[model samples]
Target chain A: MARLTKIKTRKKGGATEILVLVNHPMETGQRKNKKTKKKIPAHYIQKMVFKIDGKEVADANLGPAVSKNPLVGIRVAGVKKGASVKITWSDNKGESGKAQTTV
Target chain B: MNTIRRRTFLKGTVASGFAAVAATSGLLRPTEVMAAAWPKSAFKSKKLDKSIKNLFGSSKVTASKAIKIKAPIQAENGAVVPLTVSTTMSNVEAIGVFVEKNPSPLATSIDLTGATAFYSARIKMGKTSAIHVIVKSGGKLHVAKKTIKVTVGGCGG
Candidate 1:
């Protein structure tokens, strides 16, 4: 909600490239709290679905291993310019975010 | 409280010793589990082999020269390591990244429909270990690996 997911796209002929960056803690649940000294609950993105013009192109299943404020990308073909590229990601805590861009 | 803190401190560090491997991987212990379409068993596995097996549904991966893994030979920081996995293999259905020494070796698995076999992401490294790239093409898993030395452990926090 605070840090929105950022979607970037580039088109070269029929090939399209998409880069998605989301801001999340991506906690591993193994670290200790500075004050309370308790383990921080694991919080991270669980699923990232990429769609091109409303059609699913890539689906990423993630875990806590991803770095904080994750950055992931993919390249595809057959996408035309001016088409919409969208990314929707949901975390383990049932929270989600979305972003879209035009190539 | 002192002993517990010490144990946790040792768990967050990879230079402490290999004896802490079990405790180190335990750092990724899933507290809240997963949502739909997420692979729970694969991400929960401690060992690299088991995680790979649970991810692509088989440990039967063949060494392939087609898959290319672009990552640093040595990572100054374990918290954020850049990794790019690309392959010239045809009919690629999915790609998976694994950190051999991480508590959860399975970093992320991507199912590609219209996308190419090229994928890039940043992942955490628990220690100096092997990073494996598994490309699923034509229903078979093709694999490649690169060992990256981590100066600091990321699982610490």
Candidate 2:
């Protein structure tokens, strides 16, 4: 599972822009464990969903080919000042986490 | 044999030699040899919908063109490659990245609320793969993709 950090958002051209960083290894199952010499089962976050003011906005499909840590950026419109936006994600192992911000 | 028969045989031999030379020089129709390769089965997971909702707080997402993903055309090291995603929409919420050829597939997810529409980071690549970016804005989903060629294998191949 990945951990979210450095979440930030701002207004741009009548829309809101957001940036984020995540901490994760993003191991592909093709690699073998160093100690056991056994293949590590594929375990990566498969999907992510973004919501603004309780309205579903965007979603992404993930794969294991990605590097250790990743950063992402997004922009949304129609959000008023003080509105809240939420993000959630899940891995192949069913582990999930959530983060939120106020507009 | 007679003179006419001998002459005909010589002509046939010359024509065949010319054909062979042309084929070797690639002047003839070349064959496309497709490689025998398949995606690893372990990357396919059934929890696609669940993973999306878990990341975005909702299961609904629409594909859009507002997102732009930038990656290298070729990477010498599969262990690390620079990636950047930028968007131009308002009321943005989050961004996510994926590598299509990885065993599990999902690479990373990030939450964005009060920042710019640009994000940059480095990620590992086990092999050549497609990098995808998903952006959420104004209750809509935007997507983009780029192909990256990895020379080395990061998955211990």
Candidate of highest lDDT: 1
Writing each residue's lDDT as its tens digit, candidate 2 over A1-103 gives: 2466446778876777755555665656677878899997655655556677787655544456555554555666667888877877665544567788887
Residue ranges of candidate 2 with Cα displaced over 4 Å: A1-6, A11-14, B1-69, B73-77, B84-123, B128-152
Top DockQ hit: 1
Candidate 2 chain A, poorest ten consecutive residues by summed lDDT: A58-67
Error of 1 at B126 (Å): 0.6
Chain A TM-score for each candidate, in the given order? 0.91, 0.79
Give the range where candidate 1 chain A is weakest over 10 consecutive residues by summed lDDT: A8-17
Q: Model 1, residue B5: displacement in angstroms?
A: 26
Q: To one decimal, what is the Cα RMSD in angstroms of model 1 from the true structure?
A: 9.0
Compared with the true structure, all predictions reach lDDT values of 0.83, 0.60
